[model samples]
Target: MQATGSSHSLALRRGDFTTLIEALDYAAKGDTGVNFYNARGELYATSTYADLQVEVVALARRLLGLGLEPGARVGLVAETSPHFVRFFWACQYAGLVPVPLPATMHIGGHAGYVAQLRGLIENCGAAVAMAPVEWMSFLEEATTGLTLSFVGTPEDFDRLTPSTATLPTVAPDSIAYLQYTSGSTRFPRGVVIDHTTVLANINDMASHGLKMTEQDRFGSWLPFYHDMGLVAFIMMPMATQRSVDFLGTQDFAMRPRKWLEMMSGNRTTITSGPPFGYDLAAMRVRPSDAEQWDLSALRVACVGAEMINPEPLKRFAEALAPSGFKSTAFLPCYGMAECSLGISFAGLDEELQIDYVDAEQMQEDSIATPLDPEEAQKSKRRVARYVDCGALLPTFEIAIRDEHGNDLPERQAGVIHLRGPSVMSHYFQEEAITRECLSEDGWLDTGDIGYLANGRLFVTGRRKDMIIIHGRNIWPEDLEYLAKTQPGVNYTDAAAFSVPSDVDQQETAVLVVQCRERDEIKRARLVKTIASLVRSEFGIDVVVELVPTRTLPRTSSGKLARARARLDYLGRRQAAKMQHQPEPANSLPMDEAMPQVRYIA
Candidate 1:
């Protein structure tokens, strides 16, 4: 049966159920379900809620026959497919905790991927692991020395006989799933969430955050492993009984326009992605094709998962304006896996609100002093623009704290601490690390630097990513943004950080930019232009180096790996010094460099 049409037009609102199991049981009574699409916008697999419930119940019984106890960890390689979905719900029904492993494998980093998988399997102490037939080889290699009860493909899992034993009783406080943080797979921390926590988040996001209605339908290409994808798109839609359309991440990367086309065709109302995804679609969409599609039904296009760049949102809105797209549909949100998914969301049907601040004051004084538009235009002063990510959700509170644990007043930048029912219980099995971030008072240090202005949160940058240069705090994103505005640099093509200067052994800002120019003279000119731009804008002299395109490494979620890039820079510098060879002063050619190499000065 196709995954479309509601069997009954019952309009069930949020907060009608308290747990995901309860929500899914209510949803299965309807005909609404999920639809998967290919790169060319063709439907491949469809499953209704009723169909999924039947499969999940049967699979849960079979899994119980494996002689595993309740609360056992089941690691599932998260690819966007029917198998992953079936196995996830089966774990839920069997009272087992499901852990979604990332499906990404770096091109030449096979060993690294294996190590990452092994670390996660060991960390979660998973009793069983499963992957698709195509990924069985990787799983086999990763489980070399592990003591897993079973490690195989979905087909192998299906061969097991069902047990007549009764399923374990699951409560609201029972463990739901383990969601690992996106970056640094070598040292992964699983966010321990329960049915109560996740359901609370979903209810808030549906009722207060998105104001989701029965008419809303979800669509996305985000990978199922990411919290925003798994919780927001998959779990949230299922809870609300909303039919959703899915496109694989690889397919979306290959043909970005297909995302818009699917949304237009499916009349998807609620969808979301990071800023880079919108930017990519904006670049690929042609103005002439706008009239051929309809997007007026799209009400909320949520943006989060990374730093929100307004320029790209503007570009996307303007490019799709002819298709009846409104810029007001853009909803900038603040969230992390620790909070289950959402912390705050912008008001619906409102235009994006940006706070322009004095850059020098913000960096030097830890204050986000607003700049008047007329004064900003008259005086050629540096300004940093941050999007207002709305107020805290219901039953949530935020505190901005300084390094000494003193709470700062509004408009003062500091570490963002959040307290709510949605926050994770703890980092799985890492008590010391959990204590470092989570306080006994039930507050979670978000590790993000931001300020509150009239109750709205304006995220400045990451607290750990702040570069200290001559006692002045500099956010790397500011330097990267300045570099992107220069000719030939894309949004994610620049990574900025601070390294110890060879001459003075003091911290100095270094901007590593990726350029497409092949000619040596033009490449040098691009470097000069970027250096001059930074010096003029921020009044700091930065060591600027230009490398070939795609030289910078990115995290699995597509954000620049600033910390990794810094380590890479230090390693390359140490290697060059050990060889008694002077570092290349200007452009670094990718052909002669290591895979992890980027422009270093």
Candidate 2:
């Protein structure tokens, strides 16, 4: 396929543009539609819009031959490849719902991931599971005891025979696909999205949001399992009849600069990832590398799918300044899979809006009170500042609600409630959750903490009490499960929570593992082991602390209290810092019987 703009020359323009099938139909007319690249940033396979149409038809025919019931779910667990993109389009054309499972390998305990997949398949009633050859090993293990109908590699995709008659017809409101929610459980929640919802979101993004065009060359390393990756980068460009260059998540993780190298090499104009990604790349970039790269074409660099940190953006921009990269390219967006990807984005070609507020007032009053530099100097009060996440999309409605569900005014922190055309219809077979999320009038609760100021949305924190490390959500239970495997550690002996670090205000996870043994060396080794396990399994750094058994307070029902543990950990750290400090010049030391830990303060 051609590198960029020259696509969208031929194709039907009308119909439910909201669906992936429709996006494929439009992209088929373009001279260049979808492009895939290898780990070295070299083109591996190329296909024009016209070629996509042919490949999709044949693939859809083969899928239909599988004898899957109408609307049966087909799961894809492979990384981004020509096959991955082709199958997605084919599923749309063939009237089957394609559930794109995350391609990122689960670390620490693989069994947990398998159990999660089993739950998703059971919930979606998936008829087939497919992956690349490398992924087949995990698929086999995951599906071993289950009565699954079919499981194979991508090569087996072509072996499908088109049997019987044409595939079932689908309407605009028909379910298109199911994206599983990331955190809070081992069992994933399947988000049901429809054709209407998809198109409405894409159009809103392309027109009022990002203003994407045929000239834009998309580049991404986001996992295909993610909403931002699947809907925004993969489907949206096709919906707009544009071509995009793809990179694998593992390749990007191993060599983040490859993402920038691709953009520099291809003169690609758009890309997005979490703050950690930028931070990683920034750390690795030397002055020499910047001199060799030219990234002037970059227009939109979206930051989302995790906590947004401004420091990384600043560091990255400064590191690449010689390469003509502008700080203005950093776009902070707020979205979730439940809303089909994007709900709000920082306006393109506009200056970012940041507010410096008193942190104490924010916690106590839930009010964002801006403070001057002078007053900030006199108090221990710190400033919490962030770039505005722009205004809501045209088809979306946003409101902030208090604990009583009453809407709050601007600058007041509250839960972000929204209703939009892009919102998922429901969680598959989960009526209670569906009702709890949706209002009687049809709004989807985004489970995010934020406020509106001058019509701009600024996200503060997540109300869900989940930890998002390295762009992947990990529930406290998942970590607790791993802790129980270690000797002397039980489910009740582990408490996992996210804590802000001194280096950066963004949260880093701290896992406290309770132990009966008081041996300092043994305790230290366990801490190191837990940290290593977390790092290797999830590609994230964790701080592991050991507490004496019975020290961790529990509830009346015998459940571990995560919130209380967080407070206790904070208290311990504070006390430790105080013990190291000298006594006041005029003050006498405390009594010998008093707690020695108090001396540090």
Candidate 3:
């Protein structure tokens, strides 16, 4: 299959349309469209915008034949294939709200994945659902007990007779899709983003975030379920009449180098991923491989979806530097699904910026004071490093507020709140949660803790993840950092949180590090070393536990789920006591007293 050209002769638009249907109508005039690639960096499928419009409209007619009501929900298993793209756009033409379910199934976790799918399907109240052949069994099982008008795969839907009825007129206020957040979730809620809200965010992203031009093409391996994948790669490119190359998320995970290959081969100017993607790709790339590729055309390599770790990004840039991957192309951004994906972005053609704050003052007073360079050189232990996520778009109004809801000044770390056209009006059918997260006026409590420094946003951590010990604020990321610094430890291997203490009105800090060492002596040494570092750094004793790798739970989008970790820890602790069995050696302090260190191997 031949991929679409990067440069097209048709006029380009910058996501200025109010509805997705309108945007698609305009883009159908252009030759630029989405291209899909297989695991080996080979193009497998290509659909020009004009062809995509015809396919989706035909699919929409068949979907209308199902006799479902307008504004009905259609569940879709979001595999990174042409089927998913066709179905997503078909819903837009049919005037039905599409909800993209996760395509990933964790190793040896079938029951868990099914339950998660069931919860999402139930929550969304989907009237019809579709999945690819490989994922059909899971979708069938998930919807077994539910009442739905129709359920099938793309092939099955195609067999349905096309309706003679005309397609309904989609309003700007109509819901485009329900993006289920892949953040911390016992059960995830769908973020309801209307056509106007999503398009506004896309406009802000193109006009300000990436400064998209007609010359810019896109490439990504982020899954369709992810906001970055859906909006940035899917919507943004088509809105501007730019072609995009897509590598499946699972395929990219199996062959990380293929992502870099796709970028170089396509001469794509923009791509984005979390820090882990860079880390994985850098680990797999060779200097010789970089020397072979022509990557000078690639400019914006956006990083977001998780906290930006400068070290991994630095390594990625260095590894690909031989291929003309400039360090200035690394763009750190801050966004969430609730806000339609993109709040702030670093300056174009700027190097990644870091703000080293005094860790002590940040913990005690919640202030992000820049550390003195001379003092930092003398004793760097007091510094906390955070990447600058840059300025918010002109559309957003941000405020930093304390626990009491009093707005704080710049440089003061507090809950980050935002109000903008991009912000979602509510969670799907979750009015109680919507009320808790959003105010009556407009502001949405983002549940993130950060500070604005000189108009730039520096995200510290999540508000709910904060631990208070001896009336001093404790950030779990700091404790995790101490563990990550240890040898044989990598990023995403440590989880830190506070457990309820035996003492009155106090909590004990705990750090769980995923250790790979099998030797008893080495494991013990690693735990003790991490525990001692916590003592010296925070003046608080922490119980350090070492567990097997991949034991730490993460959200679907690859963010560490610390709250779930704590719950699992407490559950195991209770189970041990009930079985009348002793806990792991040094799993707890010698006594219930304070300032006592314990190490678990």
Candidate 4:
């Protein structure tokens, strides 16, 4: 991928304002513009503005008749479907705020889904909670005792009356949507972005960052609830008057190849997902499959929303190299929901910049001193590779600040602070929490640690979750990655965290590995192997525990909730000490037998 510098910019039209309603009007003009696809590789639906306008108008009228005021919050719960899209548009057309609720976890079972739904509806203060008919019984139980104005299924959408109330013309600065931060319950934050903010983020990303064209086709299996899925892929195409090919999130999960196939089949020029998604597809896309499909047009393959793993990116590039995929085409970006999606994006066709730093210096001085990978191998606290997240989006400003809120110099690790028009207005009604993050002039404390090098941003890890052992900041992702290398482990199935030891003055880092192996001998071998690997590689002592798979807590976007995992671990330890309850598969125990290692004083 060759870097196409700032020379690329598309002129914005006056009518093509920040409001989504205005964007939809432009998309509604043409027919044959693709909208959605179901499993089995079929294009299930297509809609022009002319067609969607009719449905949105009727739905708007029905919403008004419900006696809810304009801008009342409506909760949306469903997998990617035409109804979800239609209802979303209807909310915008009728001036209702749509808060997208997370769907059920595939592995969390029914209880987990119910708990998630309950939290979202309660947080958003929804006047209506909507889902499909199959989910009605569960929704009823989940939403019990909430002040729900109405609860309906997708079928009820057809029954909406043609709108008679005057459509409310909202300002660009009016609240457009709410994006929830993907974290544990203790750190739940809703990014409240107005229409102007959303529009600016989208336009800047599409025009300058992504370099999107009307001829470019988009494809994704990412859930609509995720920021990348909702704003970048689904909504950006409509905002830019370009067509998108979407695969259902469930379908893609069930059959990962469908994502690659859709890209190959549709000749999709743009698509984005995390490193795991790429790894999944690369693993499933077999030798025989290559001759049957073509992916010559794929352009911007983005990696974000989680810790950027360079290994998977490399493997994906090698696997698809035979099919005309370039390694340089991989765009590694860094963002949070608080910033309305994108903060920094790599250049269009640039190779990912990875900085190898002295790990000991990083922890002791908070400065990432460049180190050779060879030299790092000999030292106990040696090397760590920090992936550059490219440059800040055209309209956003970023700074690195120390604990005292003083700006730091280049290559010095500190909290990544951002101030931009695209940043959220505030956390929803949580002024205290909002004030803690946002400054008086609108800069937000991202709570992430990184540094600037050669005009690029390099993300280290979340400051709150950083593991300190013998004065070294060991990133949990690094430990979790090593744990995953053990057999019988699933993706995102391990949690590496720090726990306060009874005797140690500081925290003792423990790794909880989830595996399907139940045989005691096999489990012991796995645990011992993990411990040996950690000690040999990082020169750190760790407690390794083998638990059942699919037990780690995950946020709405399918990310591991590290903070929640630590709490769960502590609770299990207390219960075990009390001898009051048997340990459940959901919570695992770590070995307290390992001796702590000594560090150079």
The numbered model that scores best in lDDT is 3
Tens digits of per-residue lDDT for model 4, 196-273: 888888877887778876567778888888888888866777777666777888888788877887788777888888
lDDT of 3 at 185: 39
TM-score of each: 0.96, 0.78, 0.96, 0.91
For 1-601, candidate 3 gives per-residue lDDT tens digits of 7899998787767899979999999999988899999998899999999999999999999999999899999999999999999999999999999999998875238888888889999999999999999999999999998999899989999999999998999999999999998756347889999999999999999999989888999999999998888888888888888999999999998999999999998998999999888998998999999999878888899999446788889999999999999999989999999999999999999988889888889988998889866688698548888999999999999999999999999999989999999999899998999999899989999999999999999998887789889999998888998899998998878999988874573799989877776666777788878888888888898878776666788777777888888886777667666877654563433222321223542
Q: Considering lDDT, which of the candidate structures 2 and 4 is the better prediction for this target?
A: 4
Ranking by TM-score: 1, 3, 4, 2
Go through the candidates in order and give the C-alpha RMSD of each one to the true structure: 1.9, 11.1, 3.7, 5.4
Residue lDDT tens for model 1, 1-601 = 3557533576775745666777778888888888999888898998888889899989999898898988999999998888888899999889999999988865237887887788899999999999998777888999998898888898988999989988777899999999998654237689999999999999899999999877889999998888998998889988889888899888998899999998998888988988889999999999888878899989999999446889989999999999988999999999999999999988999999999999889989988989986698789767888999998898799999999989999999999999999999999999998999999989999989999999998888887689888788888988999889877788878898998888898888888877776666777677777788877877778887665566576766667778877776677678777978755554445453533223332
Error of 3 at 439 (Å): 1.3
How many Å off is the CA of 308 in candidate 4? 0.7
Worst 10 residues of 3 by lDDT: 588-597
Q: Model 1 lDDT vs. the true structure?
A: 0.85
Candidates in order have lDDT scores of: 0.85, 0.73, 0.88, 0.76
Q: TM-score of the candidate numbered 3? A: 0.96
Better of 3 and 4 by lDDT: 3
lDDT of 4 at 322: 70
**Model 2, range 1-601, lDDT digits (tens) per residue?**
3454543445423223755665676666567666666778777777876787898888888888877777878888847887778887788878888898766533224775676566666677778888888777777777777665678887887776665577566778887888887754224588999889878888888787787665677888877887888888888777777668887888886787878888888777888877667877887898999889998888899888434657667889999988888888888898888998888998886555677777556755779888875688687555566568888888888989987899999999888999978888889888888898887788888777888988989887666656765555555654655666788774357777888875777788878776665454665566667777766545567767665555665421122556667777788777766777542222321332222121110
